[model samples]
Every structure is written in structure tokens, then in C-alpha cells.
Target chain A: MAHLTPTPVIEPLQDRTMILNMGPQHPSTHGVLRVILEIDGENVVRIMPDIGYLHTGIEKTCEAKFYQQVVPLTDRIDYLCPLTNNLCYALAVEKLLGMEIPPKAQWLRVLLNELTRINSHLVWLGTHALDIGAMTVFLYCFREREDILRIFEMVSGQRMMTSYFRIGGIALEPPLGFFEKVRDFADRFPSRVDEYENLLTGNPIWLMRTKGIARITAEDAIALGATGPTLRGSGVDLDLRRDMPYSGYENFKFKVPLGKEGDVFDRYMCRVAELRESLAIVKQALEGMPEGPIKANMPKVVLPDREKMKTEMEALIYHFKIITEGFSVPAGEVYQAVESPRGEMGYYVVSDGTAKPYRVHMRAACLANLQTLPLMCEGRLIADVVAAIGSIDIVLGEIDR
Target chain B: MALAPPITDLEKLKTHPALASLLDWNPGAIEGVKFDRDEMSIVIDRAHIRDACTLLRDHREFAFEFLSDVTCVDWYPSEPRFEVIYHLLSISKKERVRLKVRLDGSSPVVESITAVWPAANYFEREVFDLFGIRFSGHPYLRRIMMPEDWNGNPLRKDYPVEGYR
Candidate 1:
């Protein structure tokens, strides 16, 4: 067996090389990520990512909890796009039960998931710009992000940890006037994106820092298992929404944005373009919003309506049974993937005809995307390492989980 | 966004001539093939994973070039207590197939497919970290999400979810 220790390269300037631990607490590395960089003066020669400071043993914890209990835990896994995690887990469990969610639920899911994408991108833009020392853009980005968070509160009650999407459908019918509020934000969002572009897109300093920095070819990006904006920035025309449509994403009319250079600038442009496209999708969803039951018809799998639970004896018993003992999923496994803001987020869930999942493995996009940091960092200046990490848009919660 | 026609078909994958030929090429490597819930999966011997993945990636007709994920299921009381599953994808073909290799409960060890797909490095390490299933040829097979001196693989069924002794 090979030694588990990393073998550092003893190059010509070995004496000049020094290892720098970037962050377990530093602001720029995003979450509790510590990158051990082997540097020769300002140039990086090797990098090792030290993770797991935030490992909550969530996967192991899932094995002990019932299926529904796991959804809140999923939210904490990728806090940026918590709804995306919720939807992916719900879809996987629903597949096991062969449950068909109502058309309204599916459409609502597409709308909420798009909003999650926008919310996540807003944070990415704010922090990414802040890392590059563009102060005003951070404030501008947060202003818009606040609107999205408020909209989330309107629907899910909780701002960040929204365990909104349940196993069979959404937790509740969206509050009245929810569509109009989202519409008001969606109507004004394109110009906000333009506001961001005006601030940084054409600025020579912004261009210099982002245009060629952290560049990776499409082949290398794909080989490293990068997806979503990171892969799209590298000119890979793959979006799980368009390619493998789920949760009624196919019903809306929108474009799958692509970029050619696969650089920090291209990634920025791709995300900016995505912000516009997501607005378009949200508008389409609002126009085509279906009127039907929010939850699936399966009483065994889906919780009954509160109104019905009060009136009907059968509904009351079903509700009591489901609440006390979580509904059991079929003895099978399914892989459900969703196009999250970061990348292709997948949930590989296994059930053994039990209330608890036998195993639930999150195919976290951050973990895979973070692997390419060393590939992008080596042979580059230490300053660009921060830019590269920002461009990857990782939520270390997801990676460490 | 008009729904793209469904890209993956289990029936089509099961009958793919190239896939059939690959199965024929390695007579004893495959244990069984199953299509459940519209997904195609083939169970393979633990030792032949590298060879199987190589064929899956190299074959022109079944070019599963991307290794999406590597995970394990710990069936504690079952004879072969671990099942190492590999999710493979072909971007051009727009198809996905899972390859499963079951490892014995005692001394669970298998060949690593990092030779076939470089992306498998982190995923293999993660599997080893959580499941304590060692990859025989993995270059840096250390714990990924756990501390270096962690006591046990927390994912195994018998491993208590709460406190450690």
C-alpha cells in the first residue's frame, strides 16, 4: 500500500518553498476550509485541501432518523440552496414510493428551485466581488439577496433552513399573493443584474483579474467532475434542467447559458446570464401556474391536509400514524439529480422497506469541484488562488457533510 | 424549456450491442444485470472493477467517460457486507448506468478505478473515509471528511449514530 501522506515535490527552489495554511477561519476561503499551500515566494507549487471541520455526521445521522426527518438535515448540507437539497431528497424518496406529485407541486418546485438558484448566485456574486476588493458590488448584491430571502420567508416561514419541499409535495400551499411578490422582484431583477454588469463587466481591473485567471479547459473541467456554472463556463453545454429535466423544469421557456473561455470572467458572465434566465423561467412559471392539489393523492405516503385531518376519521388516523412512525419507502434505491446553483446535486437514497433510509449519500458538487482547486492553483500566483476558490462557489457545509 | 426526450432507456442499455460485447468479452466478470425503476445496473466482481470501468470508458458505443459518484452501502448482517457502487455517465450518448461490486464483510477490499477516471480520487477517498473500505491502489486513501485518527467508519450499520466509547 502507498503512504497516505502527501509527497511534496522537492523542486529546484526547494529552500524557498514554504507551506501556508490559508483558512480554517479566514474570510475568503468561504466556509471552514483550510487549504495547505506549498509556495515558492508568491507562486504556488502544490495545494492540499484540509476539510471536515463542519462534518456533522449527517449521512450517518440519516441512517438513524426517519425519511421525513432527514429533509431538515439536507437543508443544512447546502445552506445556500437548501430547497434544492430538499427537492432532490424528496424526489428520490418519491421515486421509491412511485408517488406522482401534483402538477401544481411540480411547477411550484421549479419556481422555488429557480429562486434558490438566484439567491445562491447573488451570494456568490457579492462574496466573489468582495474577495476581489470591489466593495460596492457586495452591498448591491446583498440588497437583492435580501428580497429573495424575504420571499423565501413568505413561502417556507424560515429564511435559511427551508425544509419546504416534503416527500410527496410541498409543506404548505404557498401563501396568497406569493406569486405577485415574486413577480415584483422578478420584474426588477434584470436591471439589478445589469447594475452589477455595469459595475464590473467592462472595468479593466475587473477584466484583468478575471479574464484569464483560474482558467481550465472544457476537457479538464469535465474530467474533474465539475458541473453547473463551473462546467458551463468551460463551454460544456450540459445543464441537468435542460438535459435531464426534473420537477417540471421542462415546462418553462428559458435558455441554457454557455461560455467559451472557461475562466473567472466567463464563469462570472455565465452566472450573470443565468440570473437573467432564471428570472425568465420564474416569470413563465407564474404565468403557467397550475391549479390543483399541492400534495400527492397517496394517503400512505403524503400527509393529509390539516382541514381534512380535522374532519375525516381516516385522515386523522393516517396523520397520526405518519407523524408518530415515518412512512416506509420501498426496498430499492434511486439516484435523483437536480441542477442546483452550484452544480449537479444528486441524492443516492437506499431503502430497505424501513422507516429510516438504509443509506443516503449526497453527491455533493462542492466536494468534486473543490478537488480541481489544486489543479487550478499550482503554477499560479497566490493572489489568484482566492479568485479561483471564489469562482468555484462552494458551500463548505455541503463539501464537509 | 421543452422537455428533452428521455435520454436514458434501461431496455436500450441492456441490449446495447457494445455493452453486450463487453459483457461477452469478460465472461465471468459480471454476476447479474438488473433494470429497476428504469435504471440499468450490472453487478460485477470486486477485482474486475478497473477492467470493467476501462472498457466502459474506452468503448466507442458505450463511452461512459464521466464517473459521477462512488459510494458504498453497508449491509451489516449480509454476507458480502458492502456494495461499492459506481455511477458512470456518457455525455455524448446521454446515458447512465450503475456498476455494483460487492465486497465481503471481512476485510472489504477492492481495486480502485482511479486509473480509468482521475475524478474518482476524491470520491474513492470519501468512500474509504466513511465506510472503511480500502481501495487497493488508491494513491492517497486517507480519511476525507473525518479526522485522521477517527475511531471507526461511522456509516456502517452497527456504528452507533450518537456517542463513541
Candidate 2:
């Protein structure tokens, strides 16, 4: 039973060095991440991140709930990009059912997904800068984030936990002037990016803190399962939206931003460039927006419209059955990965031909990305550890779940 | 569009890149092959999963250099009660493949792929933590999501959803 008690993450190498514990509560470590660091003076000798403080067992919970009921659970995994989680879960389930999403639903998914990217990145940019001691950028980033939250509220009715996406399609059609509100934000966002860039891009203090600090090579990043800006910052050109092209992303045009140096600054720059590319994709989705039904035609799988349910007897019965018993999915497994703002967010769903899912495992990007922490920060100064953690952009809810 | 039937016959899927390479290396290594819903899954012999992963990663034609995810599915009251699934992605080719290894409930142990891809470190640890499956040669095999002192594996089918109250 010696192994029953967890081994200490690090052992002291020398008498000169001492161990230091940082945050399951510290603001800099992001959620409930506890880092055990063995340091000699200012230099870091070893770094190990201890997690599981936020564990709620969402996957175990999914096994008991109906397939449709799991969408809301997905939202709690990554609070920053709830819609992206919704989309990934929906796509995986839809693939399990072999359902064909309407063109309009696909396009709408693309539009909202990019907006969610911007929303997540804005929070990361603001908080990452704030972690590095730039307070004003936090305020500026949140200002635009407020607008994005308004857009999410407009679409999903809920601000943060937006389970707007359903297994067959979206929850409802966009309200009147929804496009107009998105268009207004899209039109005014570039200048706002410039505003933040003016504040920190060329700032000497920012550059001194981030450039050449917490660097990791492309090969090492890939080996450690790093994705999104963390891998892109190391010069790996892989974006799931462009490479795999799910949810009608092949129709849109955008560039996958790459960084030459695998450093905190490079990751920051990559995410900023991505903000522009995501906006470009959003504009494309709006310009060539498809006109048709917002959900698949499968009455058994998708919920019927309120008007149809009221008028048609079959629709009413189907609705009642779906609400009570839930639709049984085909017995199969499907892995659906999407290019979430932080990285490759994937859902590996296995169905047993029952109303509930057999196993719903979320391939959380943060959990993998967080593995690269020791690789980037082990030999660096203790202060640069903060830069490394911020650069990875981990959400503990996703990591623990 | 109606769903097409899954192709589970090993003979029909012999030409698939992943299966072809595995067959070329050692036909006995693969226990089964399935292509369903536009995704390819190959069941590998539990003893040779690590070697098969190394071969696929080093194979030039199908370079699955990145290990995307590793998970386990538990089927209780069955002989082969655990299915350890590994999702591999080729960054250059933009292709994906799944490898599964089945284990019996008596001793649910399999070789770790951390040597092939260090990324498997956390994923393997997570699977070990949740499903009570053992990954031989894993650097650290401790509970991840649950506490170290917690009793029994919670994700197993026999475990109550509400926990042992």
C-alpha cells in the first residue's frame, strides 16, 4: 500500500536547493492548479503541476444521463468556450447517429464557433497580460469580451453555459437582427485589436517579460501533446478546421498562423493573429450564409418546432416521447475534433444503442497542453514559470473533468 | 442520407494504410479491423500494442507521429471487459486512426506507449486512474481525477452512478 499514498511530485536534488509550493489558490496559476517547484535561489531545478482539485467527474455523470442531456455537461468542461464544447459534443453524437446537419445549421455553427474562439482568446489575452503585470490590457480585453458575451446571450439565452447546439442541430433559429449585431461587432473588432496591440505588442516591459522566456521546441511540443497556439508557436502548422475541416469549415478561407520561436511571446503573437483569421472566417460565414432549415429532418432525433408540435398530432407524440424517454442512438463510437481557441477540442463518444451514452470522454486540450509546463519551465527562472503557465491557457474544469 | 453498414471483415479492409502496414509487419499482431462511419479502428493484440504503435509512428507512408488521445471503455459481465483505445493523428498527412486493445477483467494490464510518444504519459495515467486498468512501464501510475485513498474504480460498469453510499 506504499503506492496508495501519492508520491511527492519532486525530490530535492541538492542541499542548496529548497522546495516551494505555489497555488491551488494563487491567482497566477489559473484555476486550482498546485505546482510543486524545487528551486535553487531564483533558478527552477524541477517543476511538477498537481491537479484534480476541480474534479467533478463529468464523464461518469454523462454515463447516467440521456444523450441530449449531456450537452449541458459539456458546457461545464471549458467555461471560456462553452459553444465550442457544445459543437464538438453535438458533432460526435450526430456522427454516431449518422445524421446530416442542414447547410444553414453548419454555417451557423461555424459563425458561432469563431465568435467563441474570439471570446476565449480575449479572456486569455487579458488574463495572460494581467499575469505578466500589464493591468490595463486586462480591462481593454474584457471590454471587447463584454460585447462577445452579449452576442452569446443573444443566441443561447444563457451567457456562459450556452448549450445552444443540439445533437441534430442548433437549439433554435437566430432571433431577428442577430446577423446585424454580429456584423456590427465584426466591423468594429479590427481597430480594437490594434488598440490592444498598441498597448503591449511594442511595449518594452511586455517584450522583456515574454520574449525568449519559457521556450519549447516544435519537436518537444508535439511529443508532449501540445496543440493550438502552444504547438503553433513552436512552428507546427496544424489547425483542425483547415486540416480536417469539420462542420463546413472547408468552404471558408483563412490562414493558419505560425510562429518561428517557441516562446511565450510567440504563443501570444500566434493567438493575436488567430483573432484576425477567426474574424475573417466569421465574415465569410455571414456573407455566404445559407438559407434553409436550421436542423436535420429527422423527427425522432430532433425536437419539433413549437408551432408544428401544436398543430400536428405526430409531432406532439414525438415531442412527448423525446422529452420523456429520449431517442436511442445507433450502437457505435465516433471521435469528433474541432479547432477550439486553446487547441484541438475533441469528443470521443461511444453509444450502446440506448437512450444514454455508454461512455463520453472529452479529449481536453488543456490537460495535454498542461503537460508541457515542465518542459518549458524546468530550467528557467522561477518568475518565468508564470509566463509558461499563462502561455498554455489551461482551464481547470476541462483538465479535472 | 442513410447510414452505410460498417465493414468489419479484415480481408475487405486489408488495403487500408494502417492495416496494410500492420499486416506487413506481422499479421498476427492485429486481432480485428473495422471501418465504420468514416473512421477506421483496428483491434491490436494486447501483447503487441506498444510495438504496433511504434511501427505506425515510424512508418513513412502513414506517419502517425502525434498521439491524439487514449481512453478506455469498460464492459462488465464479459470476458474481455476492457477496451483500451488509442487515437493517433498524422500531422503531415492530416489522417487519423484508432487502435484498440482488449483485456480481460481478471488482469486488465497492457504495455504503456509512453516510449513511442511521451504524450501518452497523461492520457495513460488518466485511463489508469478512472478505469482501474494498469499500464505497465508507465512513469507514474497514480489516481488522477480521484483521490489516492478513494475506494474502487468509479467508471467501471458495476460501480453505482451515485457512488457507494
Candidate 3:
């Protein structure tokens, strides 16, 4: 009998880099993201980002509930820009139901969405700057941002994750002086952005950490499924609002800022420019405000008029049915993408002619943006890793969802 | 930044022969697939999955070039204990297609697509972390999003929410 001897192949470990385990708990990892980085002394050899520490199983939970009940759940996805998630989910369901929102509702959504973009960008700039060792920038960014959060509260009764965007239109009419407050903040925002740029743009230290750090080409950006400012930072203008033109974004005229260098600085500049652009969009939406009903005329899908709910029997029934049983969307699958501050926030919804979504999937931009961390962090200094992580602008809620 | 490609046309392409055959191919055969206007599937066979994906992705008529995401769903005692889903997008056509693979309760193994798209690497690790579904041929198969010493897949339905001992 020939002895079956299994020879263990001793492979020579050549010039391979040493493996360095980075945080699932470290504060700068941005929400339980553990990156296993291969390092060659000071330089990162390869970075592999590990996600899902904050996975909430929200998608599966959505399947168990009625359609209307899912609105509040969406507010938790990105946490920073909750209304954008609400709008995207509603748009997906609305497409299936074939309901067209009224003009006023559309304009309101555009206004709120622009405000949400600004709010989200402010948080990004604040935390991103702080991550890069600029603590003052974080505080100053939030100072101006507090005003925007107040506006969100005035409109939706919540500071963040305002489930203000509903299936057809808004949850309700705004509180008093919502426009005046928005205009006031918009007026003050231009100078604030200049302040941010001044603090970081000219400072040699800021430039050193950002200018040449984590440079990605436009080709690699698209190949890696990069979008929003991350892709735009590479000099490719791919704003879904302008190209895809959702929520009547085509009606407005605004500039899509592009960057040639495609570095952390470029991404920062892209987002800062977007802050001004978001202000411009908000101002344009207010100026071009169309006067009409806030909700669509489709009582079948949309809730009945509030006043009619008091007297009309049909209206009362619809109001009761919509909230209780939830409106039945036509059986279909539609993927709706919105230009969220982070990137392309898409909701792929499948309806089986029921009140509940057969399958609810979110193609979160933060999740995709976080994917390129390895490509960016590899070959960079250990200290620059934090700056690179901040540059990607990831939210774990979006990634884990 | 410049604008991304828009307007996906997949509804028409869902009518393709291989997938079209799937249109009426006994919707009940698959568990997670639900039909209203057409078959909206949440589960597919491990064998013909690559074919179904190619049918949706490679076909120029329904080109979904971008692999947006890969997520795992744990449904305990549902015969198929786990469901792995892949979300794809076609920038040129501007359409979205979903491919799902079912894993029975026993041994969960799904073929790795890292060779196809590099994006699947991290996502595959995530599925491994939460659901414990091993991806064969994955360059480095280890627990991602969790410590290596983690006892059980946290997202598995059978794995108690507190963690299996």
C-alpha cells in the first residue's frame, strides 16, 4: 500500500506587506468600519474596508410593514439627509402607483431637498474637517448648520430624518415664515462657505494633507461605481439631478462644480461649491414657486384633502383607508435614484399589488463610496489614512442598510 | 462633476427568451418571487443564477453594467435559510435588475463574483459576517464587519439576536 503522503507546500513569503488591523471600534473609522490594511512601514500597501457593523435589517423589516409605515424607517438609512431617502423611497412607490404630485408639492420637495443637501454637506464638512485635525472648522460649520436644522424642525417637526417627503407629496404644510428663515440662512451661507475655504484652502498644512492625497482618476471613479462629489472631484460632472433631472431639477439653472486634481482638496472644494449651489437651487425653487395643491389629486393613492375629510364621506373613507390599510400600488418594480448630498441615493422597490413592498432595496451612495477606500488608502502614510477616510464621506447607516 | 448616464430600459428586456421563459416558468417554483405586473423575484437557484444574471447584464438590450450592491437576507426555517441578492445597474440603458440566490439551511455556499467585478469583495465579506454564507473562490475569505473570533453570524434568523453561544 503506497502511503498517501500529503506534502504541505511551504510558500515563500516574499515582498508581501505586513497586515495591520484597523478599527471596528476606533472613533475615526466612521461607525464600526474595520479596515484590514496591508502596510509596508509608514506607507499603506493595500486597504480593504470592512462594513456592516450598523446593519439594522431595515430592508427586511420594511417587507413586514405596510407601505405608509415604511416612511419613518427610511429616515434612519442615511440619518444625515433623511428627507432625501424619504423622497427617493416615495418616488419609487409613486412610479409604481402612477401618481403625479401637484406642482406646489414638487417645488416644496425641491426646496426641502436642496436644504437637506446643504444640511448633509455641512455635517460632511464639519466631521470631515475634524477627522483631518481641524476642530475649529467642525464647530464653525455646525454653527451655520444649526440654522438649517431649525428650518427642518419648522417644516417637519424633526431636526434630522424628517420623513417630510411622502408618497405623493409633503407630510403637511410648513409652519410660519419657513421661506423667510430659509432665505435668511441662504443669505448668510455664502460668506460662511468663504470662511471654510479660507481656513483650509490657503493653509499649507491643510493643502499638504488634502491636495495630493487619495487622488483617483475619473475612469477609476466610474469603474468603482463612485458618484456625487467623489466622482465630480475627478473632473467628471455626473450629477443625477442635472443629467437624470428628477423632481424637475432641469427647470432650474445651476452650475455643477468640477475639479481637475481629484484629491481630498478637490472633493472638499466640490462639496463646498455644492453648498453654494444648493443655496442657489433653494433660492431658485423659492423664486419659481408654483401655486397649486400640495398633494396630488389622486385620492386613491394620495390621502384625501384635509378639509374634505371633515364633511365628505368618500374623503373620510379615503383618509381612513390610506392611513390604516395603506394604498395599493400597481404591481411593478421601479428603481428611483435621487441626487442626495452623498451621491446617487437610489431605491429599488418591487410591489406585488399589495400594501407592502414585495422587496425594498436601497442602492445607497455612501455604501458604494466607501468601497474605494482601499484604492485610496493604499500607498499613503498611516496618518493620512484618517484624511482619506474622511474624504470618502461615508455614513455607516447608509453602508449597513 | 459631470452627469451620470440615465434612463434604464429593462422592462422590455425582461421579455428576453431565457428570462422571458422565467416570466411564466412556474412563479411558484421560486419562493421569494412575487408577481403583480411581472415576476419580482427575491430568490433564485444557485445553478442557473449566473445565466440569469448574464441574461440581465450582458444583453445589450438590458445592459446593467454597474454592480451596485450585494446583500444577504436570513430567513430561518423557510427551507432556504438564507437569500443573497445582487443589485445591478445599466448606465447606458438606465435600468436596474436584481439577481437572487437561495441557500438551504444546511451548508450555505455561493460562487464568488470577485473575478467579474472587484466591488463584490467587501460585500461578500459582509454576507459572510452576518449570514455566514461562504463564497467559494473568494481571494481572501474572512470575517468582515466583525472580529475574526465572532461566534455566530449575527444576521442569521436562527442565530439568536443576542449571539449564538
Candidate 4:
């Protein structure tokens, strides 16, 4: 009887937590990120992030290469906005050498960067929506993204890994009919954005999954080193291009979208708004497009024109020296940044008057922004994980790289 | 204000005599100002990093509130074996400064900045994972990029360039 009966007096038992490793290989992580979470009955108590699983030693590899050769590595960094990475690096190196880029090149850079921004957002929106079980949005996004990729192929001759932007300017002069194709895409893109908005903007499912989820205060976001859409979602007015203008962004007239509540929904809306802003910038670039040289006049640094090498002996010798011996940067270091689709993409380059860089480092925004994941996931349910990850809009190439 | 200068604290920093040492050297040797115009920074020795950083934080004029990035570089059996860089931010002044330290060969140990900026926890771990720099005060020093039982830091100078597990 005593064994079967419940004690009248109170007895206490210890509560234990369970630790689970999400991935160095799990597909949803978007990369090799392993998030160690402590759970109590499907509720997360603590989260620890494990990174560097895909560390390709890209930074160290940069040391063995000349400035121009490193553009290929930037393509692999985010894998989404390859042109943006190219531009950021080129700007930093150009600044180091105190070289001036022509207006046409600067404007063209803006145009391409904006297009690259659109491409990146579409991917993020599609993947984020799919992760939350909205299959149609993913399909629709991919349909339009394919067109963008085709255009990229037309201009750069490479689809995803286009190291199209060279140190001084573009690699190829935006191939024949490229401008018209971009214009056509820009013309139709606004309606397409609305279509995406129509499907998910007011949908109860999307709202439930996103709104009031993964909320971060402005102070907390900044304290965590957050930038781009994530920080904008928290209503921060800081924009690198606007506040610290680079690549002739001060000339463009586009609004920077902000969110009232730093939630998954807010971030989604901010990115959608950014899509429109990019289209506007692209249109402006084409309408005011200047007819001039794309690459700078630096024969030693910039690659020589294919025809010029045949006609000019000096051009031939310069080309040979650049590819064979490589150029040496002055002894110093510089950290340059630009607004990539994700956030602030910065490249820190150090030179000791050598063909190869003394040091090359990247401040990957995806990795930095993803650091706030645990803070966003702590109180939410397990199912909300998809929405939270979507909100951050991370590309593993950048995170793991 | 000349458009308020991109960074808020340019003139104030120029007035400080402590940073005057930079003016004596060629601008190229100091590298160039990065991110913004007002932001003042330069590289330093790896061994005296702790002392130098301590002074940077303690000094009245410089209040680097954040450590934005801590990354390493390997020159491949070259002059500068390892370059560990630290990016600092002064929120009050709205400026950023980068400090670099060089380690020529083995024993790539640099003082930890975890105390100065708590955000350094993740960054320092990445440096250790890639370049094998040992941060003395890191609470739970472990390889972030590799497995728990992994062998060598892949970002080192002598580390094989091509390998996969």
C-alpha cells in the first residue's frame, strides 16, 4: 500500500536539459553551421553556434595571389551577388592605389550591383518562403531569377560564378543588347514584386509565421554587430551608401526601407521594398547611361584590351608583366566595404610591396548577421526555426567561407 | 562642416599628439584611411599587442567600444608569417580604427580582446580555426572551423594547400 500511494508531503526532483547539435551537415542550416541548442520539452533554453566547418582558407589563399587574381575568390564568398563582391574589393584596391574610375564605369557598377541585389533577394525570398512551406513563391521566384541569370551569362559569360567586375572596371563591356535586356527586366520587375507581395503579404499563414517573430531592438541589433536589412528591420537609419557614399550612390534617388518592429515580417518587407529600390536605380542608370570607356587607363593594373595587345607593343608588355610578375601594392593595409545584398561586405588587404598580398581577410556579413540567430530563436517554438533562418537571409558560402 | 565629414571625430583625432607619430611616416607606409575619412588606425607589433590595446582602451581620447573583426593572415613562409588584425569602433565619436599585429613564424600567440569587446568571442575562434593563433584569455578555446579532434590549423603558412576530409 505504501509503495503504490502518493506522498502527502512535497518532494522535489531536478530538472535536466537536453543538448542537440543541429548540423555541420544538416541541409536547413544552409551551410556547415552547427547550432548547439539546449531544449526543455520542445522549448529552447540556450543556443551556441559552431562555425568554420567549410573554412576553405580563402583568406590565406589570397596571400599567394595578386590583386586581380583574387576577384574569383570573391565570387565564391556569397555566391549570390558576385558583382557586388567584385565592386567592393575593386573599390578598396583602387582606393589603395589612388586610381580614379570613369563615370560610366561607376554608373554601370551601380546598375549591376542593383541587379545583383534583386537576384539575391529573389533567392532569399523564395528559399525563406519555401522553408516556411510556401511552395508557390519559390517556383515563381526561380522563374524570374532564371532570366536574371541568363542576362548575367550574356554579360559575363558565366552564370553563377561571374568574376565580371575587374579591378579598374568591368571585364566585358556589358555585351551587345545587354542594356536592352536589363531594361526589359526592370520594366516588368515591379509587377512581379507585387505578385510576390500579393501571395504572401496579407496571407494569414505568412503573417502568423513571420510577424512578431525573431524580434530585435535597434540597440540589441547594433550591439550584436548587425547591419543591412536585419538592422533596418529594427528601424536603424544607417546606410553605408547614403551615410558614407561609395560607388557614386549619392547620385541615385531611392528610399531606404525600415521596419517598425524588428521581426521576421519586418525583414521580409524591407527586402521586398529593396527590390523596388534596386529596379529604380537600374532604370536611372540606363536612361542616363554615358558612352565612354569602361576600364580605367591604367595599363599596368587593368587588363589590356584584346585588340590593343595585338596593335600596341607597350600594351602587350604591360599585359605580360601583370599576368606573369603581378603588380605590387604599397606597404600598408586597408579595409574597404560596400552594401552587398546581405549586409556590409568588407575586404581587408595588406601589402608589403610584393606581387602577392601580405594578408587578405573578409568581414562576411552573413556570418556576422547569423550570430544573432540564437537571440532570435530562444523563446520561439521549434517550427518557427524555418521563419527565423529565412529572416536572416544568409548564404552559407559567405557564412562558411 | 564639409558635409559633417563621413566620420564624426576627424578633427578631434588630428588634434591629439599621441597619433602624431603616424604623420612622421609616409602615408603609404601607414596604408590608407579606410571605411571613412575621420577614422584613424595603423598596424603594430604582435608581442606588445596586449599592452598597446590596453593603452588604446584606457586612453581618454580613444574609446573603442567594439571589436568588429579579428582575423588572421598567413604569407606562406614569407616575411610576415601571420598578420592578426583587430577592427575597433568608437560609437560616441562614430569612427572605426584597425590595429594589426605580426607573427613571423611559429608560436602565433596574441593577447585576447574578449575582455575589450565581448563580440570577439566568435571572431577570435575563427582566427584560431584558420590561422592557429592562441588567444590567452579565451574562456573555452576550441577550434571553431574544424572537428574537436582535428589536427592542424588550415590557414597556417606551412599547412598543406590541398586536402579534404
Expressed between 0 and 1, the share of native interface contacts present in candidate 2 is 0.67
Task: Tell me the tens digit of each residue's lDDT in model 4 across B79-149.
Answer: 66777888765544545677778776657787786665555777788888777888999876776656555
Fraction of the native A-B contacts that model 4 recovers: 0.24
Which regions in candidate 3 have their CA more than 4 angstroms from the true location? A1-21, A38-40, B1-65, B71-87, B90-110, B125-135, B141-165
Count backbone overlaps in model 3: 11
Clashes of each: 2, 0, 11, 1
Cα error, candidate 1, residue B17 (Å): 5.9
Give the whole-model CA lDDT for all candidates, comma-separated: 0.87, 0.93, 0.77, 0.77
Question: Is 1 or 2 the stronger prediction by DockQ?
Answer: 2
TM-score of 2: 0.98
RMSD of 3: 7.5
Query: Where does model 1 exceed 4 Å of error?
Result: A1-13, B1-14
On residues A135-248, what C-alpha lDDT tens digit does candidate 3 reach at each position?
A: 899899899889989999999888886888888888788877998998898888899999988898898989888988998887677667788899899997668888778777
Fraction of native contacts (fnat) of each candidate: 0.53, 0.67, 0.21, 0.24
Instruction: List the DockQ of the predictions in order.
Output: 0.42, 0.63, 0.16, 0.21
User: Each model's interface RMSD (Å)?
Assistant: 6.3, 2.6, 11.1, 12.2
Candidate 3 docking class: incorrect
- Which ranges of candidate 2 are over 4 A from the true structure? A1-10
User: How many backbone clashes can be found in candidate 1?
Assistant: 2
